[model samples]
Target: MLYDITHRTTYGYGSDVSVAHHLAHLHPRELPSQQISDFKLSVEPAPTVNTEHVDYYGNTTTFFTIGNPHDRLVATARSRVRITPPLLPNAARTLAWQQVRDRCASDVLTPDSEVGEFRFDSPNIARRPVLADYAAPSFPKDRPLLEAIVDFNGRIFRDFKFDSRATTVATPVDEVFKKRRGVCQDFAHLAIACLRSLGLPARYVSGYLETLPPPGKARLIGADASHAWFSVWCSGHGWIDADPTNNILPGDRHVTVAWGRDFSDVSPLRGVVVGGRGHSLGVSVDVARVAE
Candidate 1:
C-alpha cells in the first residue's frame, strides 16, 4: 500500500522566544517492509541551522536551530511511503516464550545485540512484578512466543479504555495500570513494561494509522491522528507489531516512523526554547492511501 502523510505542529507563545533548538524523528526510516520517497520538512520563522543525521537505532533524525526571536513557530513534514504487511512464522511453530527469553538473555553478546537493552527499564517504562503478573495469564506453559504475545495484546485491548484525557505523556505506567485508561502512547508504554517485566524484548513504535470514513459518509480532511504501538522481537522470525488500543496487528493501514526503547527516544518533535512561556500547542496529522 502507498500513502501520502502530512503532519503539522504549531506553537503559539505568550512571549517571544529568543532562540530554540529542536530534534525531530519525523523522517520515516526504511524497513524491510516499507519504502519511502518524496519526503520534505518545512520550518517557519526559518532556522539558522538545519541538518539531518542517523540516530543510535539508525532512524533518521533532523535537527534545527532558530536564532531569531519569534512568537509563533510551525514545523511540518510530508512524505510518500509504501508499506507491505510484515510476515510472521506460524504462531504455533515459533519457539516457546521462555526459550526465546533465555536466548535473548545469554551473555555471549554481539555488537548487534541491541535487543537485550529493551528487556530492562527505560526513561518511561519500568520493569515491575505487576507488569509480569499482568502478562502471566497469557503465557501458559510452553506457549509459543507469537501465540502468547498475541493473546496478551488482546487482553490489554479488552481490559483498558482509550481515553485521550485520562493521561499525559509524562504519566507513569503503573498509574495507568491502576486507571485502566489512557491514549495510545500510554498503552504502548504499559505494553512495553509488561513484556520487559517478563524479560522479553519490546520496542515502542510511533507512526500514523489511516482512518476511513463510513461507507456513505465523506472523509474528513484532518481526522487522522498520530499513532503508537509496540513490537516484540522473536529470535528467528523477527519483530511483530501489535496495537492494543485498536486490537489489531499493524498491516497496510499502519505507517511506521520510528522505533525505540520508548516514546522519549522517538518523539515526532521536541525542543527547548529560551522563552515561550505559557505556550499553547496544536497538532494535525493526515494519512491517506494513495491510489494506484
Candidate 2:
C-alpha cells in the first residue's frame, strides 16, 4: 500500500511577532514496514534560518527561525509513503506479561534493550498507584503481553468518551481518568501511564490513522486529524503498537511520524516566540491511499 499525506497548520497571532523558532516532526519515518519515499515542508514567509537533524529518538526534526515580524504563520508538509506490513503475530502466543517485564529490568541488553528507558515517568505520563490499580484487572498473573495489552486497550475504548473538547495537550492523565473523556491523545497518555505504573516499558506514538466516512457520505476535505497511540516492548517481538482509541492493532492504516517517551518528546510542533500576545491554532490532516 502507498499513501499521500498532507498536514497543514495555521496560526494567527493577536500581535505581530518579531522573531520565532520552531521544531517539527512532520516528516514520516522509514521502516521495513513503511518508507518515506519523499517529503517536503513549506513555510509561508520562509524562515531566515533553517536546519534539519535527527533527534535522540532517531526521529527526523526540522528547526527553523523566523526573524521578520508577522501576524500569521503557516506550515504545510507533503509526503509520499509506501507501506507493506506483515500480518500481526497472534497475541496469545506471545510471551507472558511478567516475562516481558522481567527482561526490561535485567542487565542483558538485546537490540530491544533501549526500550527500557520508557518504563518511567515523562512529562505527560507518570507512575501512579491509581493507574496501576485501573490496569491490574486486565493483566492477571500469567496473561500474554499482547493479549493483556489488547484487552486493556478495549477497556479504555469502551469506558471513555471521545470528546474533542474534553481535554488539551496539557491535560494530565489523572484528569482523564476522572472524566473518562478525551480525544486520542488523552487515551494514549492514559494507557502509557497505566503500563508504566506496572513497571512496563511503553512509549507514545504520534502518527496519522486513515479514517473513513459513512458508507454513503462523501469524504470531508481536511476533516481528519493527527492521531496518537502507545507501543509496548515485547522481549522477542520488539515494540507492538496498540490503539486504545479504536481498540485495534495498528497496521497499514497507521502512518508513524515519530515516537518518544511522551507527547512532549515528539510534539508535531513546538517553539519559542519573541513576541505574540496570544494565538489561535488550526490544523488539518489528510491521508489518502494510493495505488501500488
Candidate 3:
C-alpha cells in the first residue's frame, strides 16, 4: 500500500520579539516493510538555518532556526511512502518470556549494549513494582514472549478508557494505571513501563495510524492524528510492534516515523523559543491512501 501524509503544526504566541529554534521528527522511516519515496519540510518565517541529520536512534531529525521575530510559526511535513505488512512469528512458538527477560538482563551488563538501553528507565517511563504486578497476570510461568505480550496488550485495551481529556503528556504511568483512562500516548507509555518492570527489552514507536470514517461519511481532511505503540524484542524475531490502544499488531496501515525509550525521544515536533510566551499549539494530520 502507498500513502501520502501531511502533518502540520501551528503555534500562536501571546507575544513575540526575537529568535526561535525547533527540532522535528516528522520524516517517515525507511524500513524493511516500509519505503519512503519522497519527503519535504517547510517552515514559515523563512528559517535562517535549516538542516537535518539522523539521530542516535536512527530517526531523521530536522533542525531549523528563525532569526527574525514572528508572533506565529508553522512547520509542515509532507511525505509519500509505501508499506507492506510485516511478517510476525507464531506467538506460541517464540521463546518463553522469562528467557527473553533473562537474556536482556545478562546483555545489559555489556558496555554499549543497544538492546539494553531500552530495558531501563527514561524520562517518560519508569520501572516500578506496581507495574510488574499489573503485568503479572498476562505473563504466566514459561509463557511465550510474543504470546504474553499480546495478552498484555489486549488487557490494556480492555481495561483503559480512551479519554483524551484524562491525561497530558506529563502524566505519570502509575497515575494512568490508577485512572484506567488516557489517550494512545498514555497507553503506550503504560505498556512500556510494565514490560520494562518485567525486565524485558521494549521500545516506543511513534507514527500515524490510518483511520476510516463512518459508512456514509466522507473522510475529513486532517482528521487523522499521530499514533503511538510499543515493540518487544523476541530472541529470533527482533522487534515486534503492538498497539495496546487498538489491541493489534502493527501492519501496513501503520506508518513508522521514529522510536526510542519513550515519547520524549521521538516527539513529532518540539523546540525552544527565545521570546514567544503563553503559546497555544494546534496540530493536524492527514494520511490518505493511494490506489495502484
Candidate 3 lDDT over residue span 1-292, tens digit each:
8999999999998798498888999999999999999999999989999999999999999999999989999999999999999999989999999988877777455422458668999999999999999999999989999989999999999999999999999999989999999999999999999999998888999999999998999999999999999998888779899999999999899999999999999999898888866899999999999989
Q: Report the Cα RMSD per candidate.
A: 1.2, 1.2, 1.6
Residues 14-39, model 1: lDDT tens digits: 89999999999999879888999789
Q: Kindly give the stretch of ten consecutive residues in candidate 1 with the minimal lDDT sum.
A: 106-115
Clashing pairs in 1: none
Candidate 2 runs further than 4 Å off: none
lDDT of each: 0.91, 0.91, 0.92
| TM-score of model number 2 | 0.97
For model 2, residues 1-292, the per-residue Cα lDDT tens digits are: 7889999999889999999999999998888799888999999879999899999999999999999999899999999988776467789898889888888877778655567888989888889998999999999998999999999999999999999999988999999999999999999999999999998999999999888999999878798889999999987888889999999888888999999999999999888888888999999999888875
Instruction: State, as a TM-score between 0 and 1, how close model 3 is to the true structure.
Output: 0.97
lDDT of the structure predicted as candidate 2: 0.91
Candidate 2: residue 123 lDDT (0-100): 82
